[model samples]
Target: MTRSANEYLKRILLSPVYDVAVNSDLQKLDKLSASLGNDIWLKREDQQPVKSFKLRGAYNKICQLSDAQLAKGLVASSAGNHAQGVAYSAKKKGVKATIVMPATAPDIKVEAVRNFGGEFVDVVLHGTSFEQAKEEALRLSKEFGYTMVAPFDDEDVIVGQGTIARELLEQNPDLDTLFIAVGGGGLISGISVFLKQLKPDLKIIAVESDESACLQAAMLAGKPVPLEHVGIFADGVAVKIIGEEPFRLCQQYVDEVITVNTDEICAAIKDIFDDTRVIAEPAGALSIAGIRKYLRTNPMQGKKFGGILCGANINFHTLRYVSERCELGEQKEAVIAVKIPERKGAFRAFCELLGGRAITEFNYRYSTDREAHIFVGIKLREGRQELAQLTESLGSNGYNSFDLSENEMAKLHVRYMVGGRPPSLLNEKLFSFEFPEYPGALMKFLDTLGERWNITLFHYRNHGAAEGLVLAGFDIQDTERGEFDQHLAKLGYIYQEQTDNPAYKFFLSDVNGVFEK
Candidate 1:
């Protein structure tokens, strides 16, 4: 028989063992509410023991297993939190649990799963993706007689997730909407059914990363479709396909599914960190991203809304990329990739055109094209129109430019492309200096150079430190070596001239310290 939403609600109401879940708080989001001009609340499932709502589902599912099934043991696959949830629940119920997780899963998650007493079957690095790992888990389950405890598809799991709704309504009965991150549609499916049954008019908005939007794709395709590729950044919710059971519930109960970019999700993570001093993993912070987009089109008119921070399992190496993109997403920083001729006077003219914006990164390369191209990064003004004028002026100066404001590749690796040029000649010069933190350091640096020789490459970082570092590359005109020496002496700053160093490589090398190797 097909399970009904009513049945899930009955399970929550009747299950005495699950009453503890009813105590989790539905918190008023004072800051987000003020920002959106709406009363926003958060179902703080991150406060749970496993640091996510996953525990609820795992506990519910494991508790409902028959004695024979429990004796047979259970297994599940997850990148992080789901594994911990299942492990914690199985240990509590005296059930033998074996978890299958990707080899790339975070060290903390792996440790946490072990801490919960779940035996881990470390599989061979078979698949390059999470879905393949999941398939392997299913195969192992069938072959080993272990019950497959799905992360989000089973009725018991949905009921466990729905318990969050029970707690949420008990605390804030007037909530008009709830935002929940959708991975395989388990959490949102459960919450949607519970919330819809309790308050028929309450809005359920499903938030997902655009690159890993399985539920949204499933809804649009009218069935579960395997995604050709899934983003690994939001590891927690980077599901390739929606669970068949949860998709049906989402279709019936979820009001809408909204997609957000990885950049937006990272920005939301930063926002949460700023407000609550809490560091959320990418998937954990995605629900707020939907609420932000929702406020753009629909004013809440002071109606109450809430979002759940689902899980935190971000990789440490990935944080740097997320930080850079989040700054761009919030418009606090800007990156531009421009191609300028490697000729005298052209470099100076381009720099002079950037009257007010600072230079964040300036690097050059010898392109295969006739003209050597240089990529200069500029900091944009706070006002959008001011930034537009700066780029327009760049275009006017016989240079072709592309904004890396939303480009993932450029932010991750292209900003450090400054070491491809051949060694400087006798008359060439290089200087590194610390400039005072200011609004127009780039423009000032150009003014100081005074339209002299061609600038071969430059790199600067304005990271709110005591001072910013500026590295400039110049092609000297037919001047003597004495003039170049005098120029460096006049600057009176600690510096290095790497033109003669054998460490120079055609591409970015470790010796140059220009790019991330």
Candidate 2:
């Protein structure tokens, strides 16, 4: 059913969501503003009691329920935040509810649903995916006369999410552009409809994940369509299809829809942490990611921009993945595979040619007699342009290199597997060293010892810590061990010999593989 502009506005204004959800701050992101050359504000939806804006719509829908309908109980299907929203609302209303979550839902979220609802909500672990759980929820709703509280499809829920726009204008009326993350479209639909009607000149931009861009697909088709597959990274907004009503409202009011990749989302997460000290989930950071991408192409200045930090219910392990990709996403890091000469001082010369650029990672092994391919990760000062210039420098220096910055396979799997068995045994000794992370640390290490030894294997990675770590293998005769110890003592860096480390012997070293009777 199509809702009139005034109808949505009146409903949003009259929404009783304040009974539960707080008026989250529209805080200014000073750091982001200075960096982006724009006045940036983040609507703090993550401040909600359930740590997400989902509670607003869920509670609003539950409030508008008839007394008779409340007696029949409520049912809803969600994989994460929305389930918690419905559970929170149901518990507050003292009504019986059944939340159908996918069997594969994280244990933390499943327990949270039970904890939030207490005895009021019954949780059913249904199928492997949201679609399967949703099917089961629908069946229960039809068969047992339970009312379905959809995540984003219904009118009351849309009005609930729309109230964000009401508070946004009140907090910052001078905003030139607003960025809202889109999933099933209820959030953007409500915001766009209300904001566009009241402030016709206000630009409403919709942000979406590239993996499951249902709204973009809907816009192309002029209707809501199901995606063939949806990525689970941004699970909060991983709706396979755009809701029918949301598509209608968005088609009319949204100025533009932009999609961002996984790396950009990770970068946005880090940006939010840097400015607000809040680690947002992937979906929560979508608005900020979109804003950055839009400004990159449009290149505007001194304009006010607002984005919704929609949720902060992040799984802790996900932070590991976020940290690894954030630099690449911001174009501040580049990964490459380069073939350098296999000689005693080749690595030292290569480091000298880098002109003081810090390497984030390096991995190599003794492979060929003449040349060896090394995987390298370097921190960039000027993003892609700097990377291009570095590549040119490598080529000019007679080193063949392939940029693996954009290679998923290279980033995910191959980087860790860069070390393997050498073609033959070469009196090698493995050692791990720790040096204070400071200016010219790499050069200090190279100058201290590398020129005197033939380095057979090397692995180094920076983890943003106070110390830099390196695992190095050197081709040294048994008689040089005492001299090597003296050189190491003069270097004044902490070192540990790892020649007998079991894991290295089991996987990386071939001393056990080379057979001799």
Predicted candidate 1 versus true structure: per-residue lDDT over 1-517, tens digit per residue: 7898788889876553353343556666677667668886766666777777888888888788899898888888887888888877777787887777765566677788888764433323324345656888888788988898889878888888877777788788887778899888888888788788879998888999997899888988999998866665677887878999999988898888899887788778887776676778888989888888778668558677788877655556556767766756555566665666656676677777788567766676655444545555566556345667777887777666655566543454345654464543334455555543335655765676565467666667543322345666567765456676676676544355655432122233223223211
lDDT of all predictions: 0.70, 0.86
Q: Residue 413 error for model 2, in Å?
A: 1.7
Q: Write candidate 2's Cα lDDT for 1-517 as tens digits.
A: 5679899999999999999899999999998899999999999998998889999999999999999999999999998899999999999999999999886676678898999999999999986678889999999999999999999999999999999999999999999999999999989998988999889999999999997899999999989999976765787788889999989899899999999988899999999999899999899999999999999899989999999999998877678879999999898999887778889999888888789999999897665588765778999999999988988998899976767777654565457766777778788888877764445766777777757889987776654333456788888899998998788888877677877754355335656432111
After the best TM-score superposition of candidate 1, give how far the Cα of residue 327 lies from its true spot, in angstroms.
1.2
Poorest stretch of ten by lDDT in candidate 2: 508-517
Stretches of model 1 off by over 4 angstroms after superposition: 15-22, 118-128, 299-301, 339-359, 364-386, 393-400, 418-517
Candidate 2 contains a number of clashing pairs equal to 0
What lDDT score is found at residue 500 in candidate 2?
A: 71
Top of the candidates by TM-score:
2
Would you give me the overall lDDT of model 1? Answer: 0.70
Best by lDDT: 2
What would the TM-scores of all predictions be? 0.74, 0.81
